[model samples]
Target: TQRYAITIKRSRSDINDEIKNMTLGCNRSGYYRNRLNLTENSRHRQTSSKLLNCLFKLFASRCNNTWSFEVRNSEHNYQPSKDMSVNRMAAAGSCPHQILSTIHLNDLSLMAISKTIYNELYSIRQERLDSRTPIQALLNELQGSDFEFEYQ
Candidate 1:
């Protein structure tokens, strides 16, 4: 039940641009690469990146004590039944909120994989939002803290 926040060092504009370029690069690299479903709009890209960043930080922190973090993006098809029910209730003028399952960080390998996936998706989302020139290199920059979970 630990809470974590992701503080981006760069400005929002810069991060948005970076993510936009990364998304385009990913799309161009492979037509069927389904790692991220990025739109070609700056606004959508910005929102999606921000959302992903927040989720990643939250999951990473939770993973330190658990094994994984379950993502329940309303935009994605992974919403839990309770969430769907809550949305339905809200649409019917009720304020019911559905609870989804929590993802745990059970092992080092799972944590690493989760971190990698988060980083990749975050970069791609940011690039697509910024519309900046795309880079040709793989975006693999990871913080040293990413491995700290192994020791803990």
Candidate 2:
């Protein structure tokens, strides 16, 4: 029920196939259009190039050990939609990977969450007045992140 992780060292190398395979990135593509029509397999095939590039930058930044996330056995528990039944089915299964990992032992959650964040950040950067976390708005708060992180 649980998945495992692989570690990588960042000496500024190109991203390998398996790690690239693990990132979910469909909605960021042109076809998705905020629709839930595509199946999970189709989703994984087109990972977010933007986020992958972001990860590439992250990988190149520091000469230290970092997490290289991938998820296997995820077709059983990964659904990217607003459907409750699909999510219930997904929850019944075991998901052992971290958020940084491929949202499953696949890339569903990682891709979806990253896509959402990427969109939100895009809206913020564009100075959208209605954006929940606008850049100018964050400049006033100056607080911690909504998600928790450990200082390693």
- Going through the candidates in order, what is the number of backbone clashes in each? 16, 4
Tens-digit per-residue lDDT, 77-140, candidate 2:
2233322122233245523223224333454444444444344345444554455556545654
For candidate 1, the clash count comes to 16
Query: Per-model C-alpha lDDT, please?
Result: 0.28, 0.36
Model 2 residue 135 lDDT score: 59
Give RMSD to native, each candidate.
Answer: 21.7, 18.5
Give a tens-digit lDDT track for model 1, residues 76-131: 21221121222233345532211111222222212222343344445545665475
Question: How well does each candidate superpose onto the true structure, as a TM-score?
Answer: 0.15, 0.18
User: TM-score: which candidate is best?
Assistant: 2
Model 2 — which ten-residue stretch has the worst lDDT? 51-60
Model 2 residue 50 CA deviation in Å: 16
Which portions of model 1 miss their true places by more than 4 Å?
1-112, 131-152
After superposition, candidate 2 runs with Cα above 4 Å error: 1-100, 106-117, 120-129, 132-135, 142-152
